[model samples]
Target: MMIDLSRDINLLTKFSIFSKFPLDHLEHLLNCCGAYYKSYEKNEIIYFQGDDINFLCIIISGSISIEKIDIFGNNTYMLDFYSGNFFGEQMILDTPSISPYTYKCSTKCKILCLPFHKKYSTNNCKNTCDCRLLFRENLLNQIAENNLLFINKLEVLSKKNIREKIMTFLINESEKCNSNKVQIPFSKSKFADYLGVNRSALMRVLSNMKNDGLIELNNKTFTILK
Candidate 1:
């Protein structure tokens, strides 16, 4: 989608990472960061695992998911990101490690990519740049948050059973929503994929959970009862 500069700045404000960022510095930040926008079609592969890439990416629209493929070609869903959310900070900061996950566009997507190079980022920045300090702070914050997010992903993926996976995910969601009633971000089948469980098995366990009064489920919404 072609978004005019004014509207683009407004939409950027909606992203959690950029919510507190000043609009007056938006355009300059893009310039200093070497930001350029690009679009991808549904199901397109954005960055394959092991590829050499070092650009921070922010979703301007649509969604993307980080997935991994095992040697046997089995796929595991790692995480999902929506509009305004960002990724790749860890990769950029930890440049020695090659990419460890496949980033795929789950829907038609638009994203702004900022290419960061150590040689060009500091020591001799161009004279015209004005948001250098703020931009560096942004990168530090993104890297810090991304590290915490990795830990959260590990906690959820470590569950041993479908029931355990569901419970872990639901409890985490509850903490985020600060309520017993929580809504998952994905549909049933996608949720099964996320938990690394067979779709049928997930549904069966969820059915049992509902009947056992452990939870109430209506579509993606669930309320913990016990």
Candidate 2:
């Protein structure tokens, strides 16, 4: 489906990287880059590892899971996407240019695909000259944000035990939502993978937290009582 440049500009601006660009520049980008709207059913694989690196996709709505599969066929969910986040851009930096993991739609999703220019087309002057610089700058900022996310995940992984890690993750998520009570946005199995622990272990950690008066678990929701 074709999207109107004017309408998409405002939605794109919600992304931090594109927020700095002028609306005209963004509109130029929308014109130059072919936009495709794709829909994925829940649990459907959007792209698999080793898929060709062709386009960068922006999540317009819904969530997706990025999973890393081991040789044993075990899968670990590495990350998730929401609206305003970009995915599949890491392919631009891969040496062999293969996707390192698989992206699956956790819910029904809509995404906008932006294909890279071939041979640096100068057909659209607005995009070729001015908007090109903005694109590069936006990419750089995205890289920085990704690096920060990596560091934060590493810090979480450094916790001494499951309890500490769960606590750290909960506190961080709470802060991000700007509230003490937080609802996990993923399934139990997915959340376990994100926490890098087994499902049972994660449950035990939550139980311990409740016993310690740190949090109250009601169904799937977590209320920080401390």
Candidate 3:
């Protein structure tokens, strides 16, 4: 659906990157960027691996997930892309690079795509030049953080045993929450998928851990006791 540009600008400004635009140039900036909204059903594939990516995509509502498939065709849950998070800045660069993961809408989704035009230069944006620079920095920061997270997950999953993997994963979750009591975000089955473990093995490990008093588990809620 075509939304009023002003209203759409208002929604965009809520994000940190868009908020960098000067108040006076914000509307003009949006006009120059060129954007449109797209809706999708739950479980619908948004982008298949190796597809050409060219535009910035922001989830206006609902959720998306990036699933990575290995050479053996084993699928691993990578990350969830939620509302307010933006991606695909790398696609804007002149160099060629393709998407490595399959993207699918985890729920009914509304996505906003902004064209990354090569013609648009900051030389023309003299008044909002600083804002544009800051916007670039924000994009780089996001990309760096995302890469770091994947590296961290690789470290977590490289553990040799299920108990080691589960405990490492929980400890990382604890760091995010800033507390020992951490809530698992996914249901048991999905949680197993995210952790790259067998569901039944995960259940048995949790039971053993609780019995050993290494941790306490109540459904999805876990408390790191010892």
Candidate 2 lDDT, tens digit per residue, 1-226? 7877766677778787687788887777767766578888999987898787677788898998888889999877777878777777754443454677898898999988876555234355543387777776787788787666656667778898888787787787788789988888778787787779899999987888899999998876888877
Report model 2's TM-score to 2 decimal places.
0.84
lDDT for 205 in candidate 1 is 99
Best by TM-score: 1
16, model 2: CA deviation in Å? Answer: 2.2
State the lDDT of candidate 1 residue by residue for 30-75, as single tens digits: 6555677889999998889887666777888899988888999987
Work out how many backbone clashes candidate 1 has: 0
RMSD of each: 2.9, 2.7, 2.9
Q: Better model by TM-score, 1 or 2? A: 1
TM-score of each: 0.85, 0.84, 0.85
lDDT, candidate 3, 118-172, per-residue tens: 5335334543465556666666776776787677678778999989988898888
Looking at candidate 3, the ten consecutive residues that score lowest on lDDT are 119-128
Which residues of candidate 3, in runs, are more than 4 Å off?
A: 3-11, 19-26, 119-128
Superior candidate under lDDT, 1 versus 3: 1
The deviation in Å at residue 156 for candidate 3 is 1.3
